[model samples]
Target: MRTPLFLLLAASAALAQTPRPGVNYDEAKVGSDPLPDLKLTTAEEWTQKRRPEILKLFEDNVYGKTPAGIGAPKFEVTATKTDALGGLATRKFIHISLPDRPAWPGMDVMLYTPNNVKAAPCFVGLSFGGNHAVSTEPDVPLSTRWMRESKEKNIVEHHATEATRGTESSRWPLEMILKRGFAVATAYYGDIEPDHADGWKEGLRAAVSKEGANTVWKDGEWGAIGAWAWGLSRIADYLQTDPQVDGRHLAVIGHSRLGKTSLWAGAQDERFGIVISNDSGEGGAALMRRDFGETTAIITKAFPHWFTPTYKSFAGNAAACPVDAHMLIALAAPRPIYIASAGEDHWADQKGEFLSGKFASPVYALFGKKGVGVEEQPAIDTPVGDFVGYHNRTGKHDVTDYDWTQYLNFAARHWAK
Candidate 1:
């Protein structure tokens, strides 16, 4: 006898809520070994003594080791317009070329800096769509790179067209950011590595392989996330060279997968003074051990190229992983980092993300800085923290005006001196 349709639906909903052992949810159990002692007298001592071990653990088990010299990319300015955004902003397009791979299409960077500010504190991030999608400005060049097409978004034949322009504008409020005296820099993530499993064949990984046989990453080496994070650092390298940008005040920000890239970039590169992750759940700001939503197994299976093969070892056994998201956040010691979530985005595990920030507080204390001040997750839209900040806004898993407001406020507190 088959079950009734209504009964099947009801059972599915019930199962979703029920926390299955070692699956959707895990017992909140911390390891017996304590976190690297944040009680050390000086932040310098803590950095010198404990930071390396934590960094190594994450590289070994999660994000994988980023090869050195990934930063040394040549930059070329392709175009510039002083009268963009109705004369309120200056738009510049840059081309980033990797060594020994001049034939590769390379990455394109779009920068919008307010004309009023001589040296603006900029927000640098990787975008899911092409740079053209960030704004409606006619000057922003269209990306010719391979894109994950969406007919609804007007991206036809795996290529970006004019109709896709400004589609992602909600995620990147350029005019608002410019009016607030901040600059925004963005690059298409696919230019670094396409999102598909075989994307490595056309990206930096392939470029590295062409340099020498030994440079090629073995299986389980750095994956798409690492390449995207490395791409952000290359953007940072260009930002440091520009006179319009205050390199010391650079902040790296991202949403969803790019948010994961932002955290990893901030952790590896100290040049980013402020790091912000919006709905960067699961492999991002959320603790892996929580298993509340978007479990390790789920992510690995969905995107096999996002992490190393070593990460598979702990897919169903997150408790055995030597490092957790909290440790990844802690790696940004003393830097002002903000982790935002959405009340409706349980798949990103809002609660798990908040707890990671809370657990990372002790490391901030070592630098005489504060962390998320509250013990419990605050009410929706209530932003909290000192050096480490978080807010689960009343929305879904997308960046919005409210999220940007909190980030601007947080940046003002730290960057506005």
Candidate 2:
């Protein structure tokens, strides 16, 4: 039977009005409440009082509070190669472990510093692939840890293989970074913990828990993201001791989930002079209040292990959540941060990421710093802002050389000045 034209049109309208999973794109539906004001007048007030309060809100409700008394990480320089990368850079491998918590499998960090520069500024980040995947060098050990299975990424049977080597080299760009006089320090995310629901059982979280593998996570306990961030700080700890690297000028950077990790790490550790987020939509740079692509509900359900159980409560009711991504950006304050989004990556909500920086501008103003200066989101490919940098790159979800160019320029501006 043929349907009438008007009835068909009416049905189409009804279907359009219905919301689908991961398709929350309406701007009108975004949460309208004003972001929690940085009500204090002085920088001291913001720093001494409100900053800590906001930090705790994220820790307690979102990422979970990092348990204290884990004690200092013990660092061992496993390898040093001054003639690495054909003598263009010096490479060192540092194995970091907790003395008291020997059950926890610690991470191995890879460092590359430009041989031409002494105490070169460094970029510290976590990689989805192991260090062997970042460089083509055969000597870089293949990570034997549990990895998520992906045939395309060459991670087979939850393990990294020969095919995985240099799979992610395009993202690292160690030569380009070294030529620009910046050091790169990175570790595999799985080294700290495998990225899965039961990752905690074999990760640092379990090692610290009194019950070991039998530990049941509490509502506000730290999750995978917290553990990864803690690992970044440990890299910072080792970088500070390396004469070839400028630890004081370190930048903590990550992409996707790791981008969220970098933001949380930068917020807690003031040593990261710059924080960069690439396509870290939703729980990373995007404001949760905006029911855009990837909502709190979507992320929480898909990867509940990434955040505190408390965060799951605000799944559909994001406005009720005590903190927003703007507050997370605000925590960076006077320090320079670069938030990047991809043009085709709607799943991460490009506009929501831009608005995060815009809303965070007032907090930056408190410290006499500027943020994304425009009133509206800039056109695609147009980068904006000062102390708080942002750009919607002309690509898909992954990071690329275009993104690296902006980062190198942004870091040079602040680091050189």
Candidate 3:
């Protein structure tokens, strides 16, 4: 498609227009909203009708059930070298290997929990770098995995440095998780897939492409977000078998690119009991039809590898697409889904994201839950309701302790059962 055509279909999403333009975040109308009859009269309906349909919606639109990254990844325990911030005892480290191939080999992961505790609920997140980058808690294991875009060569070769790790700690708030009795599980997203034009040249897509033709990744099989979500399922796979994990309360979480992945993971795999999205913007939580800032065109061009080639066509012509963000949010129906946005981050479309939660509410109501507690967007700090919830933090396009506290509270209200 030509560049102008790309803008014609999706440029409205990434603009910096004042007071927001092109689309209305409130009661915004789009192509069409299928699955509108969501009023659950009985509990049985929630389990059989509402919940399953939501999952199907997510599969068809976003993740499409990407299989977990394959092969026995080279696993290691590196948590012994440090202290868990907030006085919590924990183990942290890196898991290295080109599980499929070494093009984008090496993964650094950090795990925090009460030492040796069994059946603990865990929160999983995707980070930007090697394990050592996540925290200075001497408890945070130094990473050994090969990271591309690095200056030094290691056993894995050309990997990112410990300095590059945990650079986005503002989004993680591990100390908050440690104090809450919840385990924080994280891995560098690049280990699963790189964020570049030809990233598929490395990671699981290349690995899975060799043997599993039936997996269907070609059209839009596994973008960086898809790969990260797939990793969440693998984490779930590992958690299910681990003694310390509760398995029932696994919360797949992410911010920005990772935020988009979190929604896809929670929707595709029921294994993730809760999903939290922070400034997921275009593909994360905002209503695609709203055509707000960071439209389909902007994301596709800026990060071509983020989705499938088929995705680029919808750039400006988003109305032609079968689904919108509401449908994506709906896919996680009945499962507690929390979306956070920053008031100043218009690029992320806080209003649009809130409306998506509002639009998807009817589907949730069908399952006997209030999807969005209110119709009109409320003040930034006012936390409200159950089921689908959204709140604008007093900040920018990042995650903070305030966001974590709300998420933990939301999870506590829903997942604590």
Give all candidate RMSDs, comma-separated: 5.5, 6.9, 5.6
Task: Write down the lDDT of every candidate, Cα atoms only.
Answer: 0.82, 0.89, 0.68
CA deviation > 4 Å runs, candidate 1: 1-42, 210-220
Instruction: Output the better candidate (2/3) by TM-score.
Output: 2
Lowest-lDDT window of 10 residues in candidate 3? Answer: 5-14
Question: Which candidate should be chosen as best, given TM-score against the real structure?
Answer: 2
State each candidate's clash count: 1, 0, 22
TM-score of 2: 0.94
Q: lDDT tens digits, residues 103-201, model 3?
A: 445566666665545667899877755455666554355554434443322212445554554565656666667667788788777677765555556
Runs of candidate 2 with Cα error greater than 4 angstroms are 1-22
Report lDDT (Cα) of residue 286, candidate 3: 81
Error of 3 at 345 (Å): 0.9
Q: Could you arrange the candidates by lDDT from highest to lowest?
A: 2, 1, 3
Question: Clashing residue pairs, candidate 2?
Answer: none
TM-score, structure 1 vs. true: 0.90
Model 3 Cα shift for residue 265 (angstroms) = 0.4
- Best model number under lDDT: 2
User: What global local distance difference test value does model 2 have?
Assistant: 0.89
